[model samples]
Target: MTLPTPSTEIRPDLVLLAGRVRTGLGSAADAAETDGTGRETLPFDAVAVRGRHIVAVARRADVDGWNTSAAEIIDLGESTITAGFVDAHVHPLSGAESRHNALMLHDCETTTEVAERIAAFAAERGPEEWIRGFGLSFDMFVGHEITNEPFARAFGGRPGYLLLFDGHSIIASPRALERAGIDGTRDFGNNSSIEVYADGTPTGYLIESDAESLVTDLYPRMPVEARVTAVQNKLAEFAASGYTSLHQMNMEEGDLDVLRALEESGELPVRVRVSPLWRASDPWAETLRRMIALQGVSGRRWHVEGVKFMLDGSIDNGSAWLFEADTHGGGLEPYWTPSAQFTHAIHALAESGVPTATHAIGDKAVEFVLDAVQSLPSHAANTRHRIEHVETIPDALVPRFAELGVTASMQPIHAFAQRADGCDMWTTLLGRDSERAANGWRIADLDRSGAIVALGSDWPVEEFDGRKIFAANVTRHRHGSDRPAVDPHQALSPERTLRALTRNGWASIGHPGEGVVAPGARADLAVFADDPLSTDPDRFAESRVLLTVVDGQVAHRDSSLA
Candidate 1:
């Protein structure tokens, strides 16, 4: 059962066969090569890996001429091999937990479908057991609303909680709210709301942080063994999908311990970048200190390199703090902590040499982060801070991100899913003057403007499908729908999109030279059944991962590989 150890010599002990390799070396200037074209020079054959690094890449015929005594050759057949995916933003623990429990709402195209799935799950569960589910999209549902009526009927007596796709909203059954001691009328004073019925009774729906916290509290009480099993199952599924690394947003210290235990037991299968949740009452400095102390302790298997700060609420729920009042007319509130508090935290993290990635979903929120970053004293300038979900940005401020060294960590799938509603939201919230300035997945624009755009799936909120996400960036169209596309001019080329998912993603997290198959690079690569570069746009949705290699080790392979 022992796995073979990769050789440590300069000469490779393994050879990879790729049908037509897209090395992702698009332009000579953008790439690290001395060649002027910046285009990827290809051998069109095999890549050699020795130990955890790529040793050489050359033609299939030429590789045999180098050395082969200790080599293990893997023929990729017609598959195109490139760097393994580095998910820029993900909640691996949450995604894994969702994968193991309740109904998945990612595929529910309509409200009726969501209700049906919940009802089915409820029918099978015992009365006292809590019914938990996630990935619901309210915009797609009728009336742009999620009610607990259908859910209450299905699990009328049982406590039930269903989380929105964005993890910012939840529809709780009457029983669940009563169990949480929330009658739907109490406002948490943070814009998080509990929907109430006309009769002054709780409707069983909670919005934003307040709603998500209810589930967070319940998870710890679940059997420790069951939680561990759920995490393992989630990791297995992610590996099967070809993800080699993930940045789990909204994680906490307790969650970090579980990951450490998993690694200690040798049960962890993917590299994790954890960002612990930040709270007003929490000791931010002490948390960072503990995380720093644990650095390299897991031998790079698990590390908390960055801190996550929630600067704004979800845009879908009308809670996203905007620069101006939304046209739809709900009173706007700033979502970030006071500037002084955020600035102090940012400076402390910077001084500690830890990076910060704040969630900013609205123009105002993005502005707040940018302003706070700009105000940082000289000592904090090099923190390489990031603003997550810059869903809407004013044109004048776009270039400032690169100038300030802020990574525009974006989720392309959101653009596709939110196009109809998002466009209207932008126009209404930003006004006619700023409407044309609305930037939605403006990757090409941002790149040209000197900003670094890194792509992420934001999984569970969105499905973690690299190919589909890439397609979404290029086409601005959902998988099967014919709808009003977002700004097509902003679409990125396949090479650019690939880099965002690979090289750019690594760079965003301060890990460079990853996501490529060059010498001195980690031997993490993904092999697909078709040339992603030349494949039809529609076909990208159906593309299957033929092989996935992480650190020169075979991680996932099609059943036929055996």
Candidate 2:
């Protein structure tokens, strides 16, 4: 039992966000008040801010008596204040750059629609400009070969490519292949491939990053000003969705410059902690040295914190490093040609005191990452690591996550791809009867096993809406859909899901208390129109985000709301 305490020394700041407060996850619910029916109710109703931290948290009546002569107080009535959300896994830099001026195709239901949209988009661009499209769904090519034939005519001899929802594959137009001189089969020495037919004719389907880079690398670079603005706009959307910090998963070229520029002019909408990517093709020593050099590099609201490694690609693209063959005998190869090299890099990063976030989607990929963790020397315990997209793993592996202290960073929004009958690309890849098929996601399993489970949107891969993710976590169903849940038993409680989106996000980064709303905690807060815990799951997904405060400053405020 505890009560609100206002600091006698700390004064009010530029703006005081006064409102109904939920201090933290069921924290200090003992404001010591009850209603006429004897049911307990929230006792606190205001949070005072001073500079970059909360100065005090008290009842609305008591807060009004504090020294507020210099503060601009914005009263938020009935708006529930909670810890701001943290998207533990995101690719903001690349997502923004790839989406800049690209054709949005995530909604096209059929191949014909995709082609028509591509054709229309291409007609507007100059003949010399390469065309780009993003988030093309796999359902469009369910029954057909993943070749560019159906869409080749749309390019009209222009070099163009459309990225799949998996972000691990791309269907390049015929002219794009010709422009890139991709005319024959080429072994990437791993799972990545040029993807050709028996006749050695390029099918214009590139798998994994290595192969996709052949054509995508030829894309014209956007100017620094344009890149800055694009990322700025993208991050604002994140803040508007109730996010106050992002654990960015990749650091590509020109990212640092854009971040610096955004911060130099003014505050960024959200705090960004970038984890630079380490590719399989990089030279071992040089790459490690360069990554270590960026350990503490930071600007106002952004910093380089960890290194991300892709142990395997997505199951949809037949690139996941599974324990055995998928339904089509694909999804059996690791992204790293010599798998031991990945272990070596992880060991080296641990020795250098830099944490790693490995993308492991299939059962085998998850196991291999755990094995690598087991082999780490005892001294490495000081360094924390996480496995992103623990999409599938056996029941036995569930307990191992907590035993090994690996945070299970997951994107619940990914479950939107699941279908009740199990014909979705992910489920189909793993046979309906396969034991591993029953192990997908398993976020609740990890949490129950005492593993720290962090939630995220994966941004461009899924919309960065925190509300939608919250609904997805509890309902195990697409918001507003009447379809039966994909794996209903694995759904987490609303209380647990809230922690995954808030405190666990900071815990995954070795910082726990920063996500809570306390006097000493960083002043990052989110105000929702409806109390998430009490609202219906479907309605909560569409709840209005009344305000978002980062560093004691309002990042987003719905003008319509008081």
- What are the models' TM-scores? 0.88, 0.96
Give model 2 RMSD, 1 decimal: 2.0
Off by over 4 Å in 1: 1-10, 27-42, 107-113, 140-147, 187-189, 197-201, 219-222, 264-268, 281-300, 419-438, 482-484
Q: How displaced is residue 482 in candidate 2, in Å?
A: 4.8
Candidate 2 local accuracy as lDDT? 0.86
lDDT of 1: 0.71
Model 2: residue 13 alpha-carbon error in angstroms = 1.6
Best by lDDT: 2
Distance from true location, Cα of 341 in model 2, Å: 1.4
lDDT of each: 0.71, 0.86
**How many residue pairs clash in each candidate at the backbone level?**
3, 0
